[model samples]
Target: MITFAVLFIAAFCAGVQNALAGGGSFLTFPALMLTGLDARAANITSTVALFPGQITTGFAGRKNISDLPQLSFKALFIISLIGGVLGAILLLITPVSVFEFLVPWLVLFATLVFLWGSFFRKIHENPKPLGPLKAIMAQFAISIYGGYFGGGIGILMLAALTIAGLDVRTAGATKNVLGGVMNASAVLIFLFSSDVAWTQVMVASIASIAGGQVGAYALKRVNEKRLRICIIILGFGLAIGLFLKAHGS
Candidate 1:
């Protein structure tokens, strides 16, 4: 009962976070790892479970989306699709233990990226306009990282979106949509070879969806600076926790 409650509470909180600032994995991933699943299995299962959360975000934002920045959206979506697929493929091919060492650093980097997102944008950029070819390649590359282990893909995506010239809402929407695509592709990629906690994922997903609706409504009422600070605080905490878990364990 405690385990079930933990999963539900985590999912609900993560759903709200994902809806507001993005990074549902911050909660769900650790929760899964703490379960009996091995690191690889936990990662794969977590990616697979992102679908429902993405769906919730998409639906909540549906009405506000009048036009999808067609050219850019297609460019980004295609790129993300290819990247996500590749990430999944890489996971299927790579050995699990080989990745265990990388998680801590990746999480740390993602944490820093989120904590200093605005600064990262102010100081530097992706160098070019990121045409179709570049867009596809970039997303594909990020997807590989995301599929292999998505600790802070949201932070990475947001940074990328700035370069893509997408506004905050559009970028968030695009990220959610592309993220869903990545998770879906990863699901196919790991279906046969990996262990998936379907029962736990289903329950968590439900709670996340319910909480997401509430989040969509809440995003409008909240102040952006306060929210960003709160998210950064959580991101920092998650980063430290991951560091300890990776090193201490």
Candidate 2:
């Protein structure tokens, strides 16, 4: 009961965070770990559990999705799918001990990325545009990282897409779609893995969906900047805690 409660609350908050800004994994991953899952299992379970919400969010923004002149959305989609599969395969073959050691560092790196995207990226008024080939390469790399860990993939995608010449609005919607595509591939692979905790996935999924709905409704009313700041603080705190735990272990 307590485990379900924890997962429900964590996933609920994660969904809201994801709907508003992205970084749901930051919440879900740690919550899964607290439920006694190893780092690798926690990551797999979190990825699997959060997938439905991602798809829904992406679908909701579908009308706003657009293709770039240099790279069609279809091409990007294919690259994301391929990269995601490769990354998932890599994760499955990685030894548990090594993944455990890597988790803290991954979380820290993701937190830093989130921090930069949220705060610093805005400081630069104009971002240099990426050529089609460079954009494709960047998206492929981001998709692989998305499948492997997926802490700040949304922000990463948004940056890349905007630099690829899409406006902020179009880039945001396109990234959401691409994020779902990549994660869909990863989730398909995770479904066959023994690492997934289906019960936790069920609990978290339902809660997250509900939270996403609430977040969608609250989007116009809430102060998004403040919300982003709070999430960043929470991310840093979680990263620090994970580092301490890893050291103790």
Candidate 3:
């Protein structure tokens, strides 16, 4: 009962974080790991568990989505799918020990990226348009990372879209949609794998979906800045915890 409750609460906050910013995995991944799953399995399970929320948020924001002039949504989706597939394959083959060791660093890196996102967005507020090739390659790279870890991919995508000439509003909506696409691609691969905890996935999925709705409605009342700061702190704390776990074992 306690485990389920914790998973539900973690996923609820994760959904809130994803909806408000983009660090849901910082909560969900560690929460799963705490349930005695190995790092790789936890990561994959978290990906699967949180996927429905991504789809829900994406569809909710679909009408606001705009196409990038340099890269159409269809092209971007294709590139992201291919990248996500490759990344999932790579993750599947990675040794459990190696993945465990990498988790802390990955969380730390993603946290830093999340912290720098607003500054980067400010810098790219009026960026010169990216070339088509550059934009495609960038999106593909981001998609690969998204499939691999997926903590802060939304912010990364938003920054890329902004630099590629999309306005902030359109870029945010595009990020939401593309995030869902890449995650869906990865989730399909994970579904065939044996690493998932289906019960946990189901619980977290329902909780996250409900939480996403709550997050959307709470936007007016919640202080985003404080929420972001809390997420950042949690990310660092989780990274430290994982690092110790990796070293102690």
* TM-scores of all candidate predictions against the true structure: 0.80, 0.79, 0.78
Best by TM-score: 1
Point out where model 2 deviates above 4 Å. 96-128, 216-249
Candidate 1: Cα lDDT at 125: 53
TM-score of 2: 0.79
**How would you encode candidate 2's per-residue C-alpha lDDT over 1-249 as one tens digit per residue?**
887798899999877766655667878987898888988899999999988887777777677788886889999999999999887887888754544466566556655765666578766566555788998998998888788877756656765776677764566568767878898999999999999989889989998887766654554355656755654675566567657766874
lDDT of each: 0.67, 0.76, 0.74
Error of 3 at 104 (Å): 7.4
lDDT of 1 by residue, 111-179 (tens): 565555544456555445435555566567677777777666765665455445564555555666677
| Tens digits of per-residue lDDT for model 3, 1-249 | 787789899999887766655567768887887787877888899989988987887676677677788568899989888888877777887655655566677667756755665344586466468789998988998888788877656556755776677755556557767877888889989999999999889989998887766654443345556654654675676667668867984
User: Between candidates 2 and 3, which one is better according to lDDT?
Assistant: 2
Pairs with backbone N, CA or C atoms under 3 Å apart (clashes), candidate 2: none
User: Residue 226 of model 1: what lDDT?
Assistant: 72
lDDT (C-alpha) at residue 175 in model 1:
69
Q: Weakest 10 consecutive residues, lDDT, candidate 1?
A: 63-72
Q: Where does candidate 3 stray beyond 4 Å? A: 96-126, 216-249
Worst 10 residues of 3 by lDDT: 215-224
Residue 49 of candidate 3: its Cα lDDT? 91
